[model samples]
Target: MLERLIESLEAAPMVQRGDYHYFIHPITDGVPLLDPALLRDVACAMVTVMDLHGVDKIVTAEAMGIHIGTALSLMTDIPLNILRKRSYSLPGEIAVHQSTGYSTGQLYLNGIEKGDRVVVIDDVISTGGTLKAVLAALENAGAEIVDVCVVIQRGEPELGRAYTPLVTIDVDADGVRVIDTCR
Candidate 1:
């Protein structure tokens, strides 16, 4: 179903950072030109599995997750809330600290209200740091998380709640190998 994403992942360049094999791809890195077809495919896959009914908003981290969330929002006609790296000092803004495998930063979340049903989407989930922070912030804001999903999964990192990943892969110096494809 996601042939293009599969092929692109396989062809992605892998860089070794210490013992980690980081694959640079459009979906996560925003390099090599993000194909619209791939984004659409991912959004389609998410809709098939994620329960969007009664969802009041679509939420995602800034930067990488924006495009993926945008595609999903556009397709679903749901409002999107982007968590930012910098705080705007907005009245209801909530700051969340996140530590990823490579970087650590505080993400600012705003606009989600109590009892609002939300669906969280991201480009990839490697260490689950960003998603974890996002989920925590959302829950703290009293938002009801309807579902969570990512376009790509690179080895599992424990996020408190279960999330659907369109594709699962194993990376090494050789390249990215597809371990599982959802959908």
Candidate 2:
């Protein structure tokens, strides 16, 4: 189902950041070029796999998740919520702290009201720092998490919260190796 995603992942280039083997691809890195066909394929695949029914909104962290959330929302007609790096200072805004394998930053959340159902989507789940912070903020905001999914999963991230990974891969100095896929 994720044919384009898998192909892109296999062809992704890898770089070593300290001891971390980071794979750079269009979906995660926004480099090389983001193919529209690949994005459509991923959004369609997610629709088939995720239980998105009754979802009030699609939530994602800023940067990489923005595209995923946008595509998925377009496909499903669901509203999208982007937790941004900058604050709007709107009422009921919540600040989040995220520490990932490569970087750390503060993200702010808004628009998600109490009892709203949401599906969280992201580009990758390496170290799960961004997703971890996002989930915590969603919980504190009193939103019901309908589903959580990612396009690529690097290694096994102990995110505490359960998540659906569309494809799993292993990154090395050489390149990225495909490990598994959602049924």
How many clashes does each candidate structure show, in the order listed? 0, 0
Candidate 2, which segments miss by more than 4 Å at Cα? none
lDDT of 2 by residue, 15-132 (tens): 8888887788999979989999998988988898899989999999999999988999989899999999999999999999999977889999999999999999999998889998
Q: After superposition, how far is residue 24 of candidate 1 from its true place, in Å?
A: 1.0
Ten-residue stretch with the least lDDT total in model 1: 14-23
Query: On residues 1-183, what C-alpha lDDT tens digit does candidate 1 reach at each position?
Result: 689999999999988898888899999999989989988888888999999999999999999999988888899899999999899999989999999998999999999999999999998899999899999999999999999998899888899888999999998889999899886
* TM-scores, all models, native as reference: 0.97, 0.97
TM-score of 1: 0.97
Clashing pairs in 2: none
**Per-residue lDDT of 123 in model 2:** 90
Give the Cα error of residue 177 in candidate 1, in Å. Answer: 0.5
